[model samples]
Target: MKPESDGGSEIKNYLVDKREKSSSRWTRVNKTFTIYDIRLKISGLLEGSDYQFRVTAVNTAGNSQPSEASQYAYCREPTYTPAPPSIPRVIDSTKHSISLQWTRPMYDGGADVVGYVVEVLEEGTEQWYRATQKTLKTNLFVAAGLQSNKKYSFQAAGVNSNGTGEFSEPSVEIEPVEKLSIPDLDLPDDLKKTVCLRAGNTLRLFVNVTGRPAPVLTWRKPGIDLQSRGFIDTTDSYTQLIVEKVHRYDSGKYTIEAENPSDTPGPPGSVRVKDYTKESVVITWDVPSIDGGAPVNNYIIEKREASMKSYKTVTTECRKTLFRISGLEESVHYFFRVLPENIYGIGEPCEIPESVLICEVPSLPQDLHIVDIGKTSAILNWERPLHDGGSRLTGYAH
Candidate 1:
């Protein structure tokens, strides 16, 4: 006898071989004895679950494996599920683009995933557009050529023979940023006058300007009419002047003119030169608060220091910011002042605020003597002097 399950009911079939009419392969004693075990083969199944089965015993000792089992409850081919793909991460941003990278998916459904698909949507846009083509690559990608200051949304999915997998949650929209404009000119405080240098001494100054297309710079020396031959000028797009080897003759007001065709004119800047000394000098001036014209040159360094009575001339032309003095003599006091100079002429001289004195001797003790002597140590004493020949003498040491 053979039995098969149909839905919830069991259907029995009486079977008898031509030569086995009395054998257990046929109906026997109201109980069915199966000569062979019943097996089921399932065709299709979803990934990720177990299939059920059941078995039935037979009266035949040799065929005890049970041919009367519920074949409908048995599993044939098993199915395995794949893990979901990892969420993509945004790692970098630019004015017009964003970069995205992702981890591998934990599950690939039942089949191996072939590629990944990316989609993006602009803010307020109802439709989503494909951002990238299907790719097996697993590196980061830049969503380039995006609109500046615009927001966008993005998502990713896995692709296989079964078609695209479910999409991940959309990432937060990020807007592309616009490029920054150039900075405006803001002169420093305490800049009021032109720089002053002794004969054969050099001075330097600084000026700052910011703008798009870069600002143009022009230099000037006020108060003193600068002969083209007497003045030297060099320039970069940002700075205008390079005063080389300045001298006392170079002392005057210096004007720094900054201009940018892309922007409104910035304030005209100036530095004053004044207070000449044998070795060093000092200068005080005011910086322009507003950008009126263009960027100024760095500094027109002027120096005037000479071992002999006749001084050599050096000029740092096309300067904008603070000015400095160099080539000063040691053991000599100096007074320096800055002035604004430009094509218009030299501006008023800024007074010198401090005095710089270069001394020949290093700081050391002077006029030392032993007051009393011991076996190992000696008591020494000396009187500190107010000044040494109008020179500051720290002390002399042994």
Candidate 2:
């Protein structure tokens, strides 16, 4: 008969197979091999029925050395104790691996435990499988080739000279999942503004787009059905709408087209174009037919000396047209124009040729002087005036 261990340890047979030299079959061993209760006093005796008992046939000749016992003797009081291995707290977890640590068993059946075995089972599963490690490990158990998201349960056992110990209670379940990383988008959130027109002759439109692969930028004019406006063109990073000489016609709405596999619906952004006109000679203007812009808020009438480099604001009012102008030098070739303003910004000035100017004194003598003043008959002379109501000045002596 053999003593079987529930935990995994080698089976120990207490019986020595006893076949007399003539017997064909061996005898079965049982526990009833007691010998009159005095057998406990003997030193080299066993309790198993098939265990051989030595007899001495020393009749006068010194007994030959005792025959070798066929089987090992039963222990007088062999003790059995089980110490399950300690299950450790997990150190860390990653997408594909788990780390575990454990301590040595507390009770090794009164003998030094030889080794430990770890078993694992998927969470919520009953089938437990064995692992290959012979000793307790403190580092990560490199279990690769696993499902993306799953939990596994683990336990450990201790083995000693006597037998294996019971399995430890299941360690807190450990789970692993796939790692995810997102790429940066080509555009930012705050860059949603569609229109940009500066004080100079520049117009820009910006849009936002997102995808794994970056997208290309395209410029367009939404008002035009065809793409042939000659405005849309591409540069290094920007889609340029170059109005080489931006004018009133180029001062309408513009669209920015961003294209990728996902941009089929339509373009996402737009900008309004407006050119600035400051100097009186440059002849700045707005679309006369369409006043879509914030109607000119107020205009500033400016004047500069013919030889001077700087101009000064002469008048400002809510009116668009020039109504009244006074105190201007006569026949001085002075320039006059109207500047328009709006919520977006100031538009180009309406030049003088486009509008009429009222000369302070109607084309009259630019200079008058008294020469050789005299009484009624004294000689009088003066520079001839260009035009003065078509009349000559009557003389006065003063």
Candidate 3:
């Protein structure tokens, strides 16, 4: 026992006893003692017997009051080693880092657990390295600066005043991977095509993309552009542009651009008339060179007659590139044009020459009859037709 007062003389001996009453006889447990001595052993006790012990200090000043009785103890060898810590398991991970968690040891060797130690082993190596510089007071730890695509294992151990306990079983292996990247565009091959849309028709363009650190997209037109006034939407892997209506002036090259830190612009897209008849014309086109990393929404078509100075839209929202314009006047010279539209806006126009003509087949002749019949031949007569189809009729064949 330590001296209660610093001014007191050094302790000479200690009086010990195993009784509750102060009047009971006491026994001297230690004869060879020192002033600094604080621990003692009382032997010769029977196993499974209840016993309470107290001690008193004998200093030059006087014998000090006895200490409170210690709790009963069953005679047995004391254990100072702790059980192994619970298994360590991974909780989170990244390309170069891993986090782990574990439970404390099941048996603490009669002492409170003070901290834990963590260790890791790389794949293909037999050596284990400490993950933390100091013991961790909590059950969780994050190990960082690991190599990507490599496997690793981990283990944990509990610590107390007695020392570190045995390590837990090794954790299952794990591997880290690189983050996702921006989309890759298959360049010149994709640029060769152009997108075409009919006037007054809807257009939808889709752009498919892939990348790490995913890319951002924007749609653009080369020259003075039509207002988008349309919806543009995007997804994890693709983007889309929608045009409700299209016009002739909407014709031109459209560009779709993608960027993350790097930029990839697609080739220019064009629209044109495919075929035309007396009353209607068909238009078709390819997709834009670059989709601006987004899909195209729709296309637009427009037309103008030879007499009109300005072009009029035939369709506002053409879904497809091919379209047929009907209800044209016969014998009238006209012009047909197309435009490609995306969510960005309408592009430049692809127009045909203004010399296209609307013509129809001739009508049948009237009052045709057989005037006379002969044994070998018959004579036929007919009146001139009401309509000449804007051209003189050649002689008819019987």
Best by TM-score: 3
lDDT per residue for candidate 2 within 1-398, as digits (tens), equals 12222134332222223333333455433234422221233344344323343322222323334334454344444545457767755765445566666677777676776776777888778999876645543323545554423678788777766766888888977765322222222443444444444444654333334422234565555565324545555443444444533445555555555543221111111111122112122223332222222233455666665566666777776343333444655334445555555444555554444222223322444445556665675554556556542234443233
Model 3 CA deviation exceeding 4 Å by range? 1-40, 43-79, 178-398
Model 1 worst lDDT window (10 residues): 13-22
Each prediction's TM-score versus the true structure: 0.28, 0.29, 0.33
Those runs of model 1 whose alpha carbons end farther than 4 Å from true positions after fitting are: 1-84, 178-398
Sort every candidate by TM-score, greatest first: 3, 2, 1
- What's the distance in Å from true for residue 323, model 2? 75
| Candidate 2 local Cα displacement, residue 290, angstroms | 54
Candidate 1 yields a Cα-based lDDT of: 0.51
Pairs that collide, model 2: 365-385
Per lDDT, the best of the predicted structures is 3
TM-score of 2: 0.29
